[model samples]
Target: MKWNSSHKAAGQHVHQPGDKHAHAAGDGHNHTHGGIFGKNTELIFSLICGGLIGIGFGLSFIDGIPPLVSMIFYITAYFFGGYFTAKEAAQTIARGGFEIDFLMFVAAIGAAILGSWVEGALLLFLFSLGHALEHFAMEKARKSIAALTELAPKTALRKDGNGTNEVPIEALRKGDVIVVRPNTKIAADGVVVKGSSSVNQAPITGESIPVDKEPAPEGSFKIEETGKLDDKYRVFAGTINGNDLLEIQVSKEASDSTLSRLVQLVNEAQTQKSPTQQFTDRFERFFVPAVLILVVLLCFAFLVVDETFSTSFYRAMSVLVAASPCALAISTPSAVLSGVARAARAGVLIKGGRPLEDLGSLTAIAFDKTGTLTEGKPKLTKIMPLKTDVTEVQLLKIVVAVETLSDHPIAKAIVRDGKEKLGGEDLPAAHDMEAVLGKGIKAALGNDAIFAGNLALFESLDESKPSAEIVAVVRKAEQEGHTTMLIRRNQEYIGMIAVMDTPRAEAKGALEALQREGIRKMIMLTGDNQAVAEAIAAQTGITEARGGLLPEQKVEAVTQLAQQEGKVAMVGDGVNDAPAMARSTVGIAMGAAGSDVALETADIALMGDKLSLLPFAIGLSRHAKKIIQQNLIVSLGMVAILIPLTILGIATIGPAVVAHEGSTLIVVFNALRLLAYQGK
Candidate 1:
């Protein structure tokens, strides 16, 4: 196509009503899926067109038929590099929308009008190349989310009465049993009815460790519904099952599965623009029109200075090329995408660019007591046998027997401790076990009746029987924030087991790192009593503690802290804490590998139990913000300096085009540097 004819036809920029109607009617166009060449076809075509242009420019310098060949090459280059961009510009111009592409098209046309066909063609080639590179970067960043969908199985082995049949994941309904064979990915969220093996949950949770999975609890699993992580009986889709036959009853539909929700979160996050991005978009709307008007004014000023119209127009074109906002427009998104992708690889899910930016500005952080600063599992930290008559080993055996049937965290800790201490000694069975709802458990061991519970339970049975030593030990355990259990056999005081949710090994170091990153305050918020909260806080180096907080109270505490500190982040992992997380500037969920609520509610999610990634995530976010600022400064600064040079006649179209495109390339590479970021 001839450039003049095509340019005039393309100038009708607006989409006709008929075109919209055709699109609504599902016309044969596949905008989302370009034929066999795929979405990057334009980029590929542009690169080829750019190469042809280079050949054509080389041919232009030769004599005879080579110049004729160069003409052919230039025409092909114009069709490949400038066709689509000019079409878009014309459509926008028809709608009275003067976008950056229109400014670029106008500049290239002016270069051609000044008898600089090579310069104009080169301008299109470089512009298309930059556009392709930016699109490729964004595509790579978003592929992380797309990868999630590829990890899950599309079909499942549904179990029948005697035989199993293969079915699509969507066909499997809630409560439908599915058989997962060894080394297979789970098809849906479900509870294992029969199985014993370690399942790799890295796909969903970002954890490197494979968690042990067992059959569903024989007792009431709902009694201690702490979170998905606490419920080891459950498994998620996209996770790999180990070398064991697992009979799993699907609990969620295909679309409602954890992997689906994760992909949804990432997709939504990508669409939600950050503040810097929003500003850049708004600025570009005016920036392009302003540049066009400025170029026109520059042409007029040159004419008044007695310059020829061609000379003035050429200078005006140079200014337009130099002052284009392409670099500035792409600065924030490139850095944001890179930073988010890097964080995702490290098992930190930053919901969007907005949260990624907010994380860098965090002045204070509030951590939930149970699962944030400490390991959510309570462990037997202290074993005190107050009864001098009974052996420590004997007392532990009784403690284990009495608490064996309970699924409480502390009870499990006691059983674990007992098994370790017993050294293969089979404990006598506790017959006729009875539990007091909020107090303790009572069971019969041989001829003796064992009572195991709290001080309240001990006092209710016989308050006056407590000796001074027993009272002191109980008080001391409570003071240290341990969950104490009193033991009595045959109506006589025996011993007590003190359990505390111990601090995670990385908690202290993570907190220290946060302080080094300029975090001024770190507070612990918990439903646990003040003593327990303070104990964990002291161990983790938190600045303060707020205990005995209800779900709403935690929100209130977060709000108050945010008011005091400018920006505050709340970290939690339970469904109850979702409200509080929603109230904070940035809500971070800990060990959110399996919980759907935690994943949806928090702005940022840590996939594993390690707290060390918290500081690393913060540091990465700050670095991302810094990189974006640097990119913008470099891009805008280059344009600022280049525009003046063009106006003063010190620079021409060739140098201006090179400098403009060169700055954009530099800005893009600078943002890509975040992909290689390594946290200290």
Candidate 2:
């Protein structure tokens, strides 16, 4: 009897990305029945074995057919059907443990010894066929992630000052402009510098509709005097461009593309087992041996009750077949793999089964306010003309020119807005611009002295300051929790521009969805002032707001949240949220595309800037957990019911095999149901 080492090697082996076949390698069962070319070799083997069984049984029924001929067919069927089973059982026994395969193999041998060759062959055939079917079923989940790597184009049409050439994706470097032809897949992550088109980003981002692609936002272009411009309208690799042509400037190398990272993360995710899976592995380690001992004890106990030795042994074999934890071992990985695949397809990257399980039990979700709850940057929301002489446009012109020489975030926001409104309209250049430490700017705009600053700067200036009415207006704007800048021209107030870090359009709705999903607490933590934090929280429906938090304070807040609320999920862009996320129960990074830090740091990266995916992920985690529970119940329930029935002479070897394999198939199909779960 030659035991197989090949199947044991395949069981422990893991398939890497770009492997030709989706190895059926990740079920809790320590065995594989994978096939080549995405076909199940085990299924083919079972078919051949079944053919032998059918021939052997039919030959025995034929008149004048020798019993020896029928016996030969049955023996060949046994070898063909039981080879892998025997090998798997032998390998496990050598390791001083056993699994479902051992139980089924011993049961079949016991039946054959009792002169019930047909029943024994039937048991092996069903058990092998069930495992083969499991391989085919689990393959769909594996392919869902493996298929992601194939979405990207392997070659890019690189165009530069010299000419156009088709280059391998690996040859492309950052800042290289690649011409994406009409109706083709974009080969790299980048921004569009020329031409415009719509591109389907569903492959990478799980967005259903095609997004319009153009140069960066209208006013976002960085226009230097040297004619240098910033690329615009973010484009990801593996997305399909529409009929219009696009010239994309590659932003990342082939390996660092968002699509590649997503695939890499998903492949690693499948290997990290869930808590339930770990428990099953431990359970099987002890339970299999205990089942074998119980079978031995049953045979002895039955013999002591005056039963015939052969009869007692036959019943013990049936009990062994009934008690094996075939379904129990497979319960978690099957469902977890399918859940992970579904999440990847939906633009949610769940790191592994551990996080997937952890996310479901979360009671608090701590959000980093600046980028997580609000549209990260400040936008000019209001322009008030305090002085009647200057038009709103002229006031903005003075502000844009005066602030051009200053290096401040508020200054950049003003310039961006001015570019949108002014549109190439050259303005008076400011000279002798002096930045007032913390106040604002004082400069000379073509002989007319200009001062664009907050109220503090104006209050400090005795002669060059606004009237009380203008001062009152600025104070009112400040009371509204906005960054109000008072513009003054030679002691007369021109106007005021109010900037606010507004909440994202999707923030309110996404938070509401989380609340509905049983999230008990939604807190906002920011380094901004309390007024600004409260303002954003009011709009976004967050349950609590904590402002003026330093990086360490954010971590402290997360720790407090975890202690008070139980499990906390910290949501932020991975860059600033790393500390807080590390302290929380689970860390989720938003807008993970184009952010390597987010990809590497966060436990779950909501691939794009879609906040809706968070709720979708929580919904998925809860559902996957539920499926795992259902599978465990069905598996353990079958064991509980089948053992007593088999021990009492209610089931023979054939019926016992049917019942055991039927439960295994039931749990498998149940776990695969996670694929169809569309999250809310």
Per-model TM-score versus the true fold: 0.65, 0.61
What residue runs in model 1 are displaced by over 4 Å at the alpha carbon?
1-272, 298-308, 337-352, 407-409, 462-465, 550-552, 576-583, 591-594, 600-603, 607-609, 672-680
TM value for model 2: 0.61
- When summed lDDT is taken over every stretch of 10 residues in candidate 1, the lowest stretch is 1-10
Instruction: Show the lowest summed lDDT stretch of 10 residues, model 2.
Output: 1-10
For model 1, what is the C-alpha lDDT against the true structure?
0.70
lDDT string for model 2 (40-122, tens) is 77778777888998998998989998999988888888887787788788777776776667776876777677666776776
Please list the C-alpha lDDT of all candidates, in the order they appear: 0.70, 0.70
> Across residues 1-680, which tens digit of lDDT does each residue of candidate 1 receive?
00000001101122211110011111111113222468786677678778888898777777775566887887688777776567667777676676666766776777667556666676677666645544443333333333456768889999888999999999998878899999898998888788766676644442223456777766534422412434468888888887678988888889987667655533322322245655664665788888888888987875479888778877888887788666775676567668878988998877656577778888799888776777766678877787677788888888998789765445667899779878899888988888663467888989999898877777787654667788898888888878888888876887888888788889999899999998999998876778888888888899998886655576668768877887777787754455455556676887653245544556677876567898999999899999988998988899889989999989998888778778878988998999999987
lDDT of 1 at 562: 73
Error of 2 at 144 (Å): 24
